[model samples]
Target: MFESIKRDLSFIQGLLEGDVNHQHHVEYRGLSRLVDVVDLLVESVEQLERRLSELEEYVETIDEDLNELELLCYDDDEEDDEWDHEIEVTCPECGEDVTIDEDDLDDENVELLCPKCHTVLDLEEIDEEDVETVISED
Candidate 1:
């Protein structure tokens, strides 16, 4: 497309330069300048198109790298599943909800400290209905 446009502009430039015409006057100088401006604009547009193509390819490479990194870091099935479990217990003193990892509760009678109020909580005595379910995320 640039080639065809450049060819037509070249033809117009030749005509304006008085190579194929006898009217070599100052009144036709504006036509010559207009063709010069059009030629520069075409070249600038072609360069812009090339730059856009390069940027698109770079973005695709970055996206692929991110996906590969995620797969490599989270390849273990057990570890990924562990992150999906979470336990939510409310603090009796402050009434604030505290989230704890399921892995941290190794036994039935485990003691956990509340982060908000620094109160010790007994996980064994808490009823299941009082404990809220909180999903863990990576």
Candidate 2:
């Protein structure tokens, strides 16, 4: 199972390093191959878990192996942050958070007027960690 993963890693590395600009086919093909590798690994792990119920030590070893494989896929320098954060002004009249698309705004102190309330409210910087919590109660 690990051998298959190694091969898939090589495949992904090649695509990442190669000239991705000219070839669109390589992108789709590589992604599909990586997906297949993950699916196969998951199925094998399920079987391994069932068969090794008696030995806790063996299970721990398998778990470590899987964890290491997952870490290999992580790119430390890649800007993988989807939510490129920003400062959001509040609408004084409506009390709603007024945010702008990251592309349009410059990184500096500026007065941003809220279109919702037509109120130019001051904004504090927000980070990714400052996520709004939503709880659904039954």
Candidate 3:
């Protein structure tokens, strides 16, 4: 549409320039001004179209990032589920009931501390038969 308008404007300009008798006429000057204004308007519209295209591309990139972030968040939730089987034991130092994730027990280097008294709890001292695996409701 813009190309067609530009072509028509170019034709008009060619005709105006060719007519030497109407070079100093008020109507010719007025038409010349109108053409200049229309040219500027067309350039402005083209610039706006380019900017809109760039904005669309930027939005698409943001959408992809959001999808990746959502997946990472979802995977984190699933990872949390793996440690749902908690081992509850009474801390011998403070007699406080200390809860531990089941996965942490597999790591021999992991030090278990009683939260109430900050006393180091021996993982080896806790009997396997006494260690209760509590399945959380949620």
Candidate 4:
């Protein structure tokens, strides 16, 4: 479409230049100015089209990266299923209820902190009989 318009404009410009008798006429000058304006508009549209194509390519790359990150972050496994079980224990320092992941309980050296008060909670100090298992309905 742009090529056709450019060809037609070129033909009109050739005709205007060939007709030397009407070079100084008002209508000839008007047509000449109109052609220049249309030429500028066509060039602007071509530039905009190029920029839009570049933006589309950039967006596509970002979308692919996001898909890769989602797969890495949200992939489901049996190991992750074990983490679903939680243990509820009260913080001895502040008596605040603290929820700990079951996976963390397996590591005897893991230290817990109370959210309400910054006190170190020793898992070994809390007896297994006193700790309650929290089961999620989900």
* Lowest-sum lDDT 10-residue window in model 1: 18-27
Ranking by TM-score: 4, 1, 3, 2
Q: What is the C-alpha lDDT of each candidate?
A: 0.82, 0.60, 0.87, 0.87
Could you estimate the TM-score for every candidate? 0.56, 0.25, 0.56, 0.65
Point to the candidate with the largest TM-score: 4
Off by over 4 Å in 2: 1-77, 87-89, 100-108, 124-138
RMSD per candidate (Å) reads 8.2, 24.3, 5.4, 5.7
Local error of candidate 4 at residue 7 (angstroms): 0.7
Error of 1 at 87 (Å): 8.7
- Candidate 2 minimal-lDDT segment of 10 residues: 129-138
Across 1-138, the per-residue lDDT of candidate 1 in tens digits comes to 999999999898777765545456565777777888999999999999999999999999999999998888777775777657788988888987888777766776667888888999887666787588788666
lDDT tens digits by residue: candidate 4, 14-104: 9999999999999999999999999999989988999999999999999999999888777755447545788998887778989888789
Q: List the residue pairs that clash in candidate 3.
A: none
What lDDT is reached at residue 41 by model 2? 77
**What tens-digit string does per-residue lDDT give for candidate 3 at 1-138?**
778978988998888889999889999999988988988898899889999999999999999999999999989998887557889988877788888888887789999988999999888788875577888855
